[model samples]
Each structure stands twice: as structure tokens, then as C-alpha cells.
Target: MSLPLDSPALALRAAIHGALAADAPLAALLGGAKVFDVPPKEADFPFVALGEAVVADWSTATERGTEHALTLHAFSRSGGRAEAMAIAAAVQEALHDMPLALAAHRLANLRATTAEVVRDPDGRTFHALVRFRAVTEPL
Candidate 1:
């Protein structure tokens, strides 16, 4: 069977997308960077992609929970590391230790695990990887 909307993975992703889209600091820095569940093919630079979600069973006999390993990517073409770093900072600020209201699941917590800015092999593209850990349980 397919995963439900209440799936911790989906809820966590949506929460992140919503937070980034609604944050003024992020908007000012990226200026309409499209956030996507998958990397866009024909989109312009400075886009945000919701990357992988690795979920594992983190449950007790009394409750069922999921530990989600999440990655969000930011791509930039200009301003080099400085620009990517700024955007990455915003991502971290927006997400780390932030509370999220999940659809059908309860978010126990969300915290950033790592934030790294890497120079793409293309030489002109900058890649920012933002990783997080989220624990969620049924509502």
C-alpha cells in the first residue's frame, strides 16, 4: 500500500517547504526560489529542492514513531559560497529546533544535523545541503 498523508516523511517535508516559503529572511535572500519535491529540470538558478527522506521505525510498545533523516538542497549560480552560505544559514535558522504542526502526525521534534556548502563540479553552481532529524508519532 502507498504511504498515507499522515506519514511522518511527507508531513516533515511539507512543514519545511511551508516554513521556507513563509519566511521573509529566506524570501529576501532567494527572491522566489522555487521549492520542489523533486529537482526542477527547466527552472532557473537559486532553487530549493526537498531531497531524500530516510525513515526508520522509532517506536515503543505504547506509541509508534518515525525517525526521519531529511535532506534539503539549495542551488545557486551567483554570489558563490557567500550566497549559498547565506541561503544555507536561512535554511538552518528556519528549521533547526523549529516546531511543526503535521497533518495527521505529531511532530515530537525537528533539528538540523548538518549544513554544508559545496562547490559544484560545474564550477559555477553552488550546492548547499541542509540535513535534519525529525521524530514524529501518530496524533
Candidate 2:
């Protein structure tokens, strides 16, 4: 069956985007609210983009639920990994264990699982990957 428009994944993504976009510390690190699901062709550096997400059935015998594994990417060209790492830290601070308002679902838990910083293929860019795990139950 097709998932509903307000599926847990979609709702969770929207809530996450909203939270990151509104976080003052994250915005400051990014120089502005540069959180995007799809960054523009000419998107600025040092921005955060919502990356891949995997959803799985987390339902129990009694309760319907979903588990989400989501990834967020931070990009920087500041000559080192510092900027990218800082952006990743801000993202973790903004999201880890934080409550989010998800439409048609109630967030059971959310936490930043892991983060890594690496140089991009071009050799001039630093990329930070932040991953989060979340559980949700239908409202």
C-alpha cells in the first residue's frame, strides 16, 4: 500500500527541517538559514542539506510505529574541516534528543547517532555527515 501524505517519514523530515532552519546557533554557523532538502545549483558553501533517509517498520504487537534513520550533510570550503565540523556540531545540538512536532505522529524519541567529517573529492571542500535515529508512533 502507498504511504499517506503525512507519513511518519515525511512528517519527521518536515519537523527536522523546521527545527534546523529556526535554530539560532545553527543558522549562525551557516551564516543564515541555509537548510535545504535540495540545494540550488549555485548554492552557497557552509550550508546544511537534508540528505538520505531510511524508514522501517517499528510497530509492536499493540502499537503502530516507525523508525527513521536520517542523514544531514554540511558543506564548507573554509580551507579546513573546522567550519564543517562546527556546522555538524550545531546540527547535533539543534536536533539530538530534542522534541519535534510531527503531523499525524508523535515523536517517541530522537537522537544524533553519529557524525563524520571528510574532504570532498574535489580536494577543496570539507563535508560533514550527521546521522540521526528517531522513533515515532501515530497520534
Give the TM-score comparing model 1 with the true structure, all chains together. 0.93
Evaluated at residue 57, the lDDT of candidate 1 is 99
Task: Give the Cα lDDT of each candidate.
Answer: 0.86, 0.95
For candidate 2, the C-alpha RMSD (Å) to the true structure equals 1.1
Q: Candidate 2's residue-wise lDDT over 28-64, tens digit each?
A: 9888999999999899988999999999999999999
Stretches of candidate 1 off by over 4 Å are none
What lDDT is obtained when candidate 1 is compared to the true structure?
0.86
User: Best by lDDT, which number?
Assistant: 2
* lDDT for position 118 in model 2: 96
Task: State the lDDT of candidate 1 residue by residue for 6-59, as single tens digits.
Answer: 677887788888988888888788787467777658877787888988999999
Compute the lDDT of residue 65 as modeled in candidate 2. Answer: 96
